[model samples]
Target: MEITHHNKTLSLNSPVVMGILNVTPDSFSDGGQFQQQAHALEHAMQMLADGATILDVGGESTRPGAVDVTQQDEIDRVVPIIKAIRERSDCWISIDTSKAAVMRAAVEAGANIINDVRALREPGALEAAATLQVPVCIMHMQGQPRTMQSAPDYENITQEVAQFLSQRIDACIDAGIVRQNIILDPGYGFGKTLSHNYQLLAQLEAFHEFGLPILAGMSRKSMIYKMLDKTPQDILGGSIACATLAAAKGAQIIRVHDVKETADALKVVAMAVRENHELGE
Candidate 1:
């Protein structure tokens, strides 16, 4: 399968790694490291060299209990970095934000994808995404970031997530966004308990019924750290393992902080899948 957006097509024959570039000072991982234009561009280049197919640039931190950043500040934080990356490489760039204005500005700068945590539910966001004509990833967050994790209760986690994503997909389509341009993320840690997170991961393949690409962002989340009793700095192994499992289970995009490691692990998954296909043939 392939994802087409802005006259560019990315093949999903092999799971692609989306390197995380948080240009914010308070992201759960790698925060405050690349807020500078020079530092952000340098790190983005390194991720491309390490086999990241997409560079996801986020100015706001969506970590649990995070507050919102002003729209202009977010635009300022990301546009320069997006422009610098565009000037340097043709690799896919994704603007990770929920604000409509930022989405428009980022695509104007060079972003090929709109990775929204709010799934374009923010005011004017759906319209902005439809007009941008780029592939948009709609994530399923049960509650707003500030209070999502406080009390995440769901009768049936997987079904509810799937239902939420389905409704968002319909909303996007109804807003003139092309169906093929839609991508789905289960929003792994947003508003989900540890058990809820694992349940979603285990049943992630169920989302394939939607016939859209799945973007898994399980890297360095509480699901990994809490389960392993490790801190964010020490969860690389767990993160990579989740990436590999997601790839093997048919995820098309793996969003990760450790691009090189996750890319390497997906390589192994790709090889195994390829061999299996050849044998079946």
Candidate 2:
């Protein structure tokens, strides 16, 4: 499958890597590392070179307990970087935000996808994405970011998530957002306990019933670090493992910090899938 935006098209026949580019100072991992315009551009180019098919640029920090920035601040942080990357390359660019204004500005500055963690539940978000006409990734989060992790209780993790996404998908279609332009993300670490996160991953294929592409973003997240008793910086292996599993389960995109490693792991996944098909034949 392919998603088209303006003059860019992203193929989803196999799993693709989406390099994380957080331009905020307080993100859980690699925060403040690419806050500068030049550094962010450099990292964007490097990620593209490292086999990333898309660059997910974020201005606000969505980590649990993270403070929200003003809309203008978010636009300022992300637009220039998007423009710079667009000027240098025509690779797919995804703007990670839920604000309607930021979404408009990012698309104007050359973003191809709207990767909203709020699932377009924010005021005006659905309308903006509908008007922008780019691919939208709606994630399932139990609560708001500041308090999502406080008490993330759920009856059945996967079922609840799928239900929420189903409602959102209906809402998006109602708002005139085409079904083909939608993506699903089961919001790992957003409001999930460690076990809750794993439950979602294990049953991820259940979401395929929706027939939309799935975007798995468990890179350096607390789900991996906390389970392994390691820091975010030390969870590369865990991150890649999760990416591999997600790809094997038919995830279309893997959002991650370590682009090269994730890309390499996806290569193995592709090989194994081919071998399995051959054996079946």
Candidate 1 RMSD to the real structure: 0.8
Which residue segments of model 2 deviate by more than 4 Å? none
lDDT of 2 by residue, 135-187 (tens): 99999998899999999999988999999999999999999988988999999
Query: Looking at candidate 1, what is the lDDT of residue 246?
Result: 88
Q: Candidate 1, residues 1-281: lDDT per residue as tens digits?
A: 77787568999889999999999999987789998888888999999999999999999999987778999999999999999999999999999999999999999999999999999999999999999899999999988998899999999999999999999998999999989889999999999999998898888889999999999999999899999998988999999988988888899999999999888899999999999999999
lDDT of each: 0.93, 0.95
Residue 214 lDDT, candidate 2, scale 0-100: 96
Write down the TM-score for model 2: 0.98
**Pairs in steric clash, model 1:** none
Task: Quickly count the clashes in candidate 1.
Answer: 0
> Which sections of candidate 1 miss by over 4 Å?
none
Best by lDDT: 2
